[model samples]
Target: MRTQVAIIGAGPSGLLLSQLLHKAGVDCVVFERRSPEYVLSRIRAGVLEQGTVDMLEQAGVSERMRKEGLPHDGFTMAVGDTRLRIDLNGLTSGKNVMVYGQTEVTKDLMDAHEARSAQVIYEAENVTPHDFETDHPRVTYEKDGVSHEITCDFICGCDGYHGVSRTSVPKAAITEFEKVYPFGWLGILSYVKPVDHELIYANHPNGFALASMRSETLSRYYIQVPAGTDVNKWSDDALWDELKIRLGAQAAANMETGPTIEKSIAPLRSFVSEPLRFGRMFLAGDAAHIVPPTGAKGLNLAASDIHYLSNGLIEFYGEKSSAGVDHYSQKALSRIWKAERFSWWMTSILHQFPDLGAFNARIQQSEMDYLASSHAAQVSLAENYVGLPF
Candidate 1:
């Protein structure tokens, strides 16, 4: 098979990239290691920055999201028992975020791909990109006990952190930076109404807790646990009891609890790979970087990467300009680092550190106190939460 672009992975990043490229009349193919059912079954962050929402609109997949996704102007944070609300829309001049699940976004993109009859090779095994440095780059994979090869002008490594694309790069050619947090988030999705209309991030003596939602009636919440915590150890009732303690009295009082539809634990990590481009292949989304979910920048960062990437591809194919394609890595990394900083800062301020003694704990408290008292501090928080300009 031959195409204009060979896209690795069928996650939101790859799917969205393919949709945008195809809309621009650029032919591309997506390869996935998992079945469609398995791909869609994975749960992920739902908060969408304004930029990501705009990209979805541009991709012509916003109808369902605009109809079903919840838009929020603000979110709450607790410092001890005091809840501080950050006016995201107000501080950012009406810019806000949408609470739409990533799964839904993937589904929409998948539907768009099918409507256009774009190619997505699912259940592809041993997918690899070869000759990326040369003029003619190609991807190889196996399907149904048969070998296949796809030659393309460019290759997009959207496969994610553990994916083959990033790993395909020689270690000496790339510099990697990473920080693994000592704790993990134990999250649950349930069919109960959220404790509050907007999401809440809580800082308590026990740990950090978050009250979020997928919709008006479908709630998603998380609490900090040990690094290797097991989901099976916490029953639905037990999880609720712990959440009530960390979220404070008022929220816990009005919060409804029910059997969890899904539960899992995700370890926190902040990672970034420099120079997103390697010859003819470019890395986007989790393939190039990762951020802790505290600030919900994962999907938004990916969207920004796609924005830069799709523009580069479009310029190459439409305008016959190599400028965007040439500078894609530098431009995308500039934005990626900012999001990474924000996510790291939020995580540090809100999460409990085992070795953080009296002085450090008081410092963290002071930061939260100032954030609530100072308009400037709140505005800064709101601006970053809504997303930095892309």
Candidate 2:
């Protein structure tokens, strides 16, 4: 098979890129190592930055999001016993975030793909990109024990961290930066009303906890746990009990407990690979970078990557200009570093670090206090949270 672009991975990044390119009349095909069901079954963060929402709209796949996604103008942060609210809408001049699950976003993109009759080959095994550095790049994979290949002008590596896309690049061609946190987030999803109308991020003596919701009835909550903690060790009641204690009295009083439906522990890490573009192959989303979920930047960063990549490809195909394509790496990396800093800062301030001294605790408290009191600090947080312009 031959196409203009071959996208590896049918996740949101690849789907969004393919949809955008399809709308722009650029032909592309997607290859996925797993079935659609398996892909959608993976639970992920729900917070949506403004730029992500806009990009979904640009891809013509956000109608359900606009209809069902909850909008939050602000969130409350509990520092010790005090709960302080960060008014995102107020601080950012009416800009806010949308609470929509990543699963729903993928579904919408998939639906749009089906409507357009776009190509997505699921269960493509051993997928590999070839000759991306040359004028002609191609992808090869095995399906149903049969080998197949696609000849394309360019390749999009949208596969996640463990996927073949990033690994395909020679180590010498990419410089990597990574920091694995000493903690992980033990998260649970349940069918219960959320503790607060808006999300609440709590910094407690024991640990950090976040009370978030996917909708009015679907709650997603998380608490910081020691690294390598097992999810199976915590019973449903124990999880709720710990959450109540960490979230404080008022929130706990309003919180409802229910049978846990999904539970897992996710390690926190900040990672980036410099030079997003390698010859004719471009890495987007988790393939290029990762961030701690503290600031909810992972998925938003993916959206920005697609924005940069799609525009660059569109420019190249339309005007036959290489300007956007040439500078894609630098442009994407500039915004990525800012997000990385924000996520790292938020994680540092909100979570309890192992072996942290009393002096460090006092400084963290002072930082939170200043963030609560200073308009400049609030504005900066709001702007980054709502997302910088794409």
Candidate 3:
């Protein structure tokens, strides 16, 4: 098989990349290792940055999102029985965020590209990359226990961190920066009603917790858990008790409960590999970097990668200009670093550090206080949270 571009994953990054390339009239094929149902049902990531929303709008995929996505004008931070609301809308001129899951994005993008049949192949497996240095890069994989090969002008390594794409780039060719947080997020999704309109990030002496929701009948919540925690030990009652304690009993009150749908633990980490491009193969999304979920930056950053790569590919192949393509790596890295910084900031501010002395505690309190009281501080958080222009 031959294509103008070969996308390695059907995650948000690869799917969106294919759609953008198609809009540019670039012939492309997408190979997804998982079935479409799995991609649409995988529950993760619920915040859409302002920049990501803009990209979706420009790509003409925002009709469903604009209609269904929950808009948040700000986020509330609670610590020591006091709540501080960061007025994002008042801070950043008319900027806002959307509380929608990544799974919905996969569904929406797939629906938009429904007419572009033969562009996506699901249940594909054993994806391998080869001859990326040549004009035709080869991506070989097996489908239904049969071997196959796909040839493209360029290969997008969007499979993710654990997939073949990142490892395909030699360790010597890639400069990596990574830090694993001392804690992880114990996430739960229930049929409970949400207690608040927008998200609340609560910081307590016990730990940090995030309160969010998926829809009117679904409440998605998270509590900071022990590093390397075991999910098996947590029962539905135990999980709800922990959440009630951390998020406050009042907020947890009268929250409906059903069969605990999804309960999983996610490690907090910041990972980045420099020079997201190599030869004819380019890396985008989770294949290039990962951020701790504190600031809700992971999926948004992946969207930004597609935004950059699609624009660059169009300029290179459409207008016959190599400028955007040549500068793609450096251009994407700038926004990546900004998000990394913001994610780290949110993580550190909310979590109580073990080594933090009384002075440090005071400082943290003062910082949070100023963020609530000062316009400049609110603007800084607003701009970072709503997102910086990509």
Candidate 4:
């Protein structure tokens, strides 16, 4: 098979890219290693930067999102009993965020693909990209008992961190920077009204806790736990008790508890692989970088990557120019680094570090205190939260 672009991974990044490129009349195909069910089953963050919401609109998949997604102008940040609302709309000049689950975004994109009969091969094994250094790049994979190959003008790796796309490149060609946090987030999804209309991020003596929701009736909550903590150890009631302590008296009073629909513990990390481009192949989304969920930048960062990449590819095809693709890596990394910094900063201020001693704890509290009192600090937080411009 031959195509203009061969995309690896059918996640939101790849699917959204394909949709944008297709709308621009650029032909592309997507390949996924897992079944569609498995892909959609993975639970992820729901907060959407204003830019991400706009991109979904551009892709024509925001219908459901517009109808169901929650829009928020502000959220509260708490240090023990003290709470300060960061007025996202006022600080960012009417800019705000949408609370929409990543899974729903994927489903919308997938539905669009299916309706258009876009080529997305799922459950393909041993997928590999070869000859990306040359103008002609090829991807190969096996399905059932047969092997197949696709030759394309370019290859895009949206396959994620453990994907084959980045691993295909020589180690010396890519520089990796990573920091693994000492703690993880123990999160649960339950069918109950949220404690607050807007999200609340709390830093307490016990740890950091976030009260969020997927919808009006679907609550999603998290608390910081030591790294390598087992999910099986915490019963639903036990987790709820800890949440009450960390979220403080006000939130605890309003909080509602229910049977958890899903539960998991995810470790925090900040990772970036420099030079997202390798010859004819490019990396985007988790394949290029990862940020701790503290800043809610994970999915938003991916959307920004798709913005740069899709536009670059569209320019290359529409104008017969290579300039956009040529500078794609540099441009994408510039934005990527800023988000990495914001995510890192959010994680640092909000999470507790046991080994850092009491001095660090006091410093964290002081930072929060400063944020509450200073308008400039609130503006900065609002800007980053609503997302830096794409």
TM-score of each: 0.99, 0.99, 0.95, 0.99
Clashes of 1: 0
- Model 1 weakest lDDT span, ten residues long: 78-87
- Model 2, 1-390: lDDT tens digits are 899999999999999999999999999999999999999999998999998998898888989999999999999887764568999999998999999999999999999988878899999999999999999999999999999989999999999999898899999999999999999999999999999999999989899999999999999999999999989999999999999999999988999999999999999999999888899999999999999999899989999999999999999999999899898999999999999999999999889999878998888899888987899998998899999997
Tens digits of per-residue lDDT for model 4, 199-296:
99988888999999999999999999999999999999999999999998888999999999999999999999989999999999999999999979
User: 157-223, model 3: which lDDT tens digit per residue?
Assistant: 8988897888887788889999988889889998878878889898878788888987766888888
The residue pairs in collision within model 1 are none
Off by over 4 Å in 3: 253-258, 357-359
Candidate 3, position 285, lDDT:
95
- Measured with C-alpha atoms, the lDDT of residue 147 in candidate 1 is 99
Candidate 1 deviant stretches above 4 angstroms: none
Give each model's whole-structure lDDT.
Answer: 0.94, 0.93, 0.86, 0.95
Winner by lDDT between candidate 3 and candidate 1: 1
Q: Which one wins by lDDT: 1 or 4?
A: 4
Candidate 1 lDDT over residue span 67-157, tens digit each: 9999999999887646788888888889999999999999999899888788999999999999998899999999999999999999999
Look at candidate 1 and tell me the lDDT of residue 329: 95
Better of 2 and 4 by lDDT: 4
Model 2, poorest ten-residue lDDT window?
76-85
